[model samples]
Target: MELHRNRGALVLPLVCVLGGAALLLFARDGAVLHRIVGGGGVLLGGVVLAGLLRPFRFAIGADGLTVRLPKLRRLIRWPEIDALALDQPPAEQGRPASPRLLLVPAPGVDLGLPATGHHPRDGRAAVELLDLDRVREKPAEIAAALTRHGGDRFVDVLGLRQAAFDTSDFTVGLRGYQPDRVDALIRRGQDALVWGGTLERQAARSEIERTRAEGLPVAGRGYNTTQVDAALARLSGALTGDPSTDRRPTT
Candidate 1:
């Protein structure tokens, strides 16, 4: 599968280029201020346009992954990859408001890909970043594709859990399971899905049972008992290796 660039992002640069040209055309010959502004606009717009116009290609094939960008172009064979993680970049003033894909190479193997920055989880590893905000494909789609092609290499750090629970809306009722307890248990289950191992899976299953047995605290305004129970049952099924409830990629 080949990811496509976000064409919508081109609007600003296009506007800049056009507006700059217009300013240059209408500026008075003797007006230094107008001339400076016009020239600056054109230069700024041109630089940004050039950067945007650079060829960007990301493709996944049976044999390897292909990444073609302005400064990097290489086919990373499957064997060279140790792990492919989806990392959530911190929300900042001038950062992409989307998760990035990290290409973590195997030990002693250097693909020479440029590093945009360091991921907290990957600390000091020479991992390359693939910004998803620039790509038109949804992050879930990309994750699915990577999981399908990369198999065990894909480590879902954040997207999988967020995708599963971020939109969960349980019916709020006067008498029901405590929202905090249910949410905490659910988070543990989700984390197990991401960090899969026999031990972790078993622990998650045990926790689900213990939580169910102990019962959640009741609150005046809480999630519906029935809905919460159903959700936990499904989560337990997923932890217990029930194929029907298991939506995540196998570790």
Candidate 2:
């Protein structure tokens, strides 16, 4: 997977170049030193701009999953993956709102990130989780891709909920079925909409809204485990004609 944080990395450099040029033209100290400094600023600005346009990669290769930072010429291998953890510590603990992805090394696997003082270094001095972006955006797509190419060697897709909570280690969640299955259920309901099953679609919609209102973690769009299980139980009971077994209310 090749991704780029195009918007984020370009804004500052553009502003700096424009500002520097303006300063060079109007400043009283527009001497040789100022020209030289302005030239250097322009060069650095181009470099930063190029880095933003370039694609960053997350590829599953013959050796393992490699995260490539083309700008930095660095590759992080999966065997070096120690712990795939997430951090959403309470804000009171001084943690940020969104979670981050951390890369922990395995027992013997030597990831070049720590030694280089930049895990998955993309020209940054420190290894930070914010480097990997759009993680939660396409969990199901990522899960399916991993299964197709990586031969199930990647993290288990079903255990993502529990895996999302590690502190010290890097935890990779959404590999679990929570997101994938829930997404499937939601799409199924949406598909029903085409067949004029409006009531069934509404049921799915209500399930989604209720879950969000309840403050339960939703894995993917319209994929709430609690709602799915409850709906499934009700459907099965209905098919069996066992009214006693049905948990849904009678209308």
Considering every candidate listed, which one attains the maximal TM-score? 1
- Per-residue CA lDDT of model 1 for 1-251, tens digit only, reads 99998887778877777887888899887877877777777788788878877999999888878989876698888998877888765534322246788877777777776656554333645465587878899888888888889998886666667654442668877887776677668767877766556678789879999979988888777888988888888888877774346565444
Q: How high is the lDDT of residue 132 in model 2? A: 33
Q: What lDDT is obtained when candidate 1 is compared to the true structure? A: 0.75
Model 2 C-alpha lDDT per residue in residues 53-171, reported as the tens digit of each score: 66655654455455656533445555555434322222222122333444445566644455322322122233333333433334444445544544433332222422311112212
C-alpha displacement of 249 in model 2, angstroms?
Answer: 29
> What is the lDDT, from 0 to 100, of the residue 64 in candidate 2?
49
Per the 3 Å backbone cut-off, how many clashing residue pairs does candidate 1 have? 0
